[model samples]
Target: MKNVLTYACMILMLTSSFMVNAQLPSKEKQYLLDFNKSTHGEQWQNKWNLQEDPSTWYGVEIKDGHVTALKLYRNNLKGSIPDGISILSELKTLNLAFNTIDGELPEDIFLLATLTSLKLEMNKLKGSLPQDYSKMTNLEELSMFNNLLQGEIPNGIGDISNLKTLNLSSNYLEGSLPKSIEKLHKLERLELFGNKLAGAIEVDLGRLVNLKELILSYNQFQGDLPSSMATLSNLEFVQLQGNDFRSLNSLLRLQSSKLAVFDSDDEFLNMKFGANEANRTRLVDTKYEDTKRN
Candidate 1:
């Protein structure tokens, strides 16, 4: 009789384990649930509500109960993001640009550890930003330009050491850029144009070893650029027009190798230094007349 009771107990335990495993949703499905609170997201809540007819959703891709991607570009979405959208443990991409969504972005979004791309631009978002922004360490692309965002840019953002492309232009953000940015050693493209930012653009910006496009035009920056050792030896071009650049005479001819354009303006454009040379004179012309391009 003791043997019989032991066997029954083992069977019960095995059955319980199986049930728990079956109930756990796959990593992808959790992602679908994470960003489903946005305007069009509501239509994707129930799989049965969607599986029967897939076209109703602006865009959604799921496999094995996991959401792999979501694209709602130019959808005219409205309303606040629901906290539940943070459950997308396997979600990789999210694009909800060109809409009228208002209010602060949900802080819980930082819980998405696997997210790589995020585009929330051209909206009405406003807030200080969530502390968990560092949790998105795997992020490769981030764009939130043309929004009503405000307050300090999160300093811990440098914790995302693998970031490649970043665009935070056209916002109400103010304050000095975090010194931590020098740690994004793998960044390729960075754009922070059109904001109310002040203070010296961090001189360490030249440390991004792989950076190609560095556009920081249209702001209140003051002071000459630091002559620190540069990390962007491979830089394709740099745009520094429409600011309070103090010393252009020193920077215009620093590298005979010639940056696509180490641009500066007429007030400080030293014609005498390179006035006799054709290429050198062209830099002055480009610096002034070509300011619109960079």
Candidate 2:
């Protein structure tokens, strides 16, 4: 006909350029073999790889080909922890904390919404503490201290809101400590020491107005102390030691008393019960002496 329509237009333009060159380098080697089978290919420091194996592993970061940072910290990694690491959806950063890896903690890592920093803390991981962690709203820093985690601490974690440092200290967690954490207003450091949190000692935590440091030492919190905590005033450090005090004009009516070191193993038993029943025993700083001495 016309040389068979110009050889069928050069065989359909070389079969559409060989199917776009077999799909852009096979989707960049399947994104570096799905990040080298999710780090099971162990590696320490291998600065940005194209295919540079020091003895195999962690070295395959390609830009216009996908797969970003995947740092392997304190690499003495044991076994377990492989699920193609959420297929590395252009991951921002994922540090596999000081290793000795046990189990749990792989629910697709909350789908890395441009994850900030998630150090999995000294591992031996148990369960409960991952409702997609409230969808990781660009989380700041969430270190999982001494793992073996139990339950309760996930009331959608006050929806992140760019959370600061929330270290869940010494785990085995129990209940009651979630009044929406008084809505973490750009919280500073709130370390819950030695777990088993009991109730009442709340004042909506004075609405956390840029709080400094407030450690709930040895959990088992008893009641009263919420005279709006003397208006927070960028409060300094205040550790209510041990627990179950219930006196000392209830800690000087918490007009905060210039607290830089308000440690109460029972500060002289709250000053001998606010000077021997100041109000003839209305009991435990009654409304902070009826709203600061009526």
Candidate 3:
């Protein structure tokens, strides 16, 4: 009787595992397999056993028979992303940062309407951002810093109304700040440092009342620092060095008591302030340095 019971338990477990594997649609499974092959999965730091069930795949999140998230940060993933990635229709988050992934970003990646957070920072992705990015309405965080991307930031970026963090620093992106960017009312952190962007910041940044960290150093931006920025009471860290701005005098009226690190080209602007104001904010007016990335 003991032997029979043990055999029955093993059979039940096998059946349950089979059922779980069967839940994933065959098309989606093929998409995963293609992704593995295209990215040299066998060489990854944490690779998946293709012979096993899709649920057991590394960095893949399966929910209700659909791939929901794929996070493989710093996992030694090489080669470019497969175009079939858009087939994972229910994917909500896709993070493949700090890897050796190269080539132009697959256009299908922007078609994932369900994606809420898309992080591909510190990769070798090259090419300009797509012109029509309005489909990613659910995106909350879009970070693609430290890449070789160039061309102007698309005007369609303003359509992602829910975006909170937008970091595209250390890239070769050029052109002036888009006028449509002022539509991000919920934005908190905006970092575009170490780019080739130029022209006066004409966008109405005062609309972003929730902004906290604003870094735009090491660019070709000139003209007066917009006075509207002073209304951002939530700002904590502000860096605007390495630019040819006429003056940063408007920032002296900043109302944020939480201001800690305020980096700028002090010598270039010949900026001077009273001791009372300097002591209150502990403002650091020094040259901004670019962060070393791997």
Query: What lDDT score is found at residue 107 in candidate 1?
Result: 71
| Residue range 94-160, candidate 3, lDDT tens digits | 9888888898998888888999999888889998899887778899999898889999999999999
Runs in model 2 deviating more than 4 A are 1-119, 122-139, 147-163, 171-185, 192-230, 233-239, 243-294
Tens digits of per-residue lDDT for model 1 on 21-59? Answer: 344465434434444545555433232243532223446
Error of 3 at 267 (Å): 5.8
Worst 10 residues of 1 by lDDT: 285-294
Worst 10 residues of 2 by lDDT: 285-294
Q: By lDDT, highest first, what's the ranking?
A: 3, 1, 2
User: Number of clashing residue pairs in every model?
Assistant: 6, 1, 0
In candidate 3, which residue ranges exceed 4 Å CA deviation? 1-20, 267-294
The estimated TM-scores of all candidates read 0.72, 0.30, 0.86
Better of 1 and 3 by TM-score: 3
Q: Could you tell me the lDDT of residue 175 within candidate 3?
A: 96
Candidate 2 at residue 90, lDDT? Answer: 61
- Best-matching candidate per lDDT: 3
Show where candidate 1 strays beyond 4 Å.
Answer: 1-56, 229-231, 248-250, 253-263, 266-294
Q: Using TM-score, rank the candidates from best to worst.
A: 3, 1, 2
